[model samples]
Target: MNIAQSYEKPRWSADLCSCGDTGTCCITCLLPCITFGQIAEVVDEGGSSCVLHGCIYGALMVIQCHCLYSCLYRGKLRAKYRLPSEPCNDYCIHCCCEPCALCQEHAELKNRGLDPSKGWIGPPNAPPPMPPSMIK
Candidate 1:
């Protein structure tokens, strides 16, 4: 459980290696850019979009340093959630287990009632979404 680090902070609901959901694991394994972007969008409070971030991540693959970029989001996610660095630092986790790490973050967001699939609607306490007809 505590592979590394020392601090009293909120722990992840699930272990990083668990993948939490099979579908998430599959996506992360085959297309980690998608996973990373989804996480990044949520962490960015949806200031940017999943597609935009995903494209950037995919482009980073050519240089093979996408993991570092993704790691920064992991830090942001941790700060937002007040989660501690455990089972190793984010750098090591993303570098060594990028797929699993991405899957875990996606699962974590879902568990916390923040659906990455829906993108960012607003703050957690924002009013319910308006009907599509009202959006004109």
Candidate 2:
């Protein structure tokens, strides 16, 4: 499948997403899920523009930018709930595996054309990608 064309919502405008939307990141061995609701909450709470999904997008951009072996690190859920000034190095911003349960549930709900503005039940994943040069 064309990773770029698979999801309805891409990462270009992920920062502006509202709620119930889904996005992918390259931080783990599986696809990590992200939702607009989570984005909004992080933004509203004065958190950094970077979230788990954002980090995935970041890593992909790094690969596109550097054209080398740059790994995607897993983000820290515990630090996310903390103040924006706190250390979020857990998100790795380089390589990661930790997934968020609430975020994934929200994305699934949105995919089904349902609203999950309240909470989430599923977990997020972070799947690795084949290098662009390896693809025919």
Candidate 3:
């Protein structure tokens, strides 16, 4: 059947408040953490408007203050300039939590006086190179 014929007596329409297109939960869940520009860009990318409760993304934003402390207190990935190491990232920004060779090398080099920007482990201006995607 053609698209129009299939929808002749549709269960829902985009105009309906309950319809998927008008969903606002993603924005609602990420409300306090994400900036306006970030939210707009994520929506523009066709991300689903529904956010699962207890999902990692939502959790990360929810306890941002605590996570920041945890990353510093537990992960111990902090800058040397501060006496009490400040949290570099809490939400796995730049895949900080994931296994990244560049980050590992950077961590090692951070002990030395050599600047990461002047090293071959990573590009002068880049944080680290992300791994390639795998096919199913």
- Of 2 and 3, the candidate ahead on lDDT is 2
The residue pairs in collision within model 3 are: none
Number of the candidate with higher TM-score, 1 or 2:
1
lDDT digits (tens) for residues 4-119 of candidate 1: 55555578887887967888788889988888888888889879999998998999989998988999999999999999897889999989988888988898888887877678
- Candidate 1: which stretches are off by over 4 Å? 1-8, 129-136
In what order do the candidates fall by TM-score, top score first?
1, 2, 3
> Which run of 10 residues does model 3 get worst, by summed lDDT?
12-21
| Least accurate 10 contiguous residues by lDDT in model 1 | 1-10
TM-score of 3: 0.17
TM-score of each: 0.85, 0.22, 0.17
Give model 2's TM-score versus the native structure.
0.22
Give the alpha carbon lDDT tens digit for every residue of 20-107 in model 3: 2112323323342222222222222223222321143346656544234223322322232222211244335323432121233233
lDDT digits (tens) for residues 20-72 of candidate 2: 23333322224332333343333233243325444655465455531111221
Sort the candidates on lDDT, descending order.
1, 2, 3
Q: Judged by lDDT against the true structure, how good is candidate 2?
A: 0.34
lDDT of each: 0.86, 0.34, 0.30
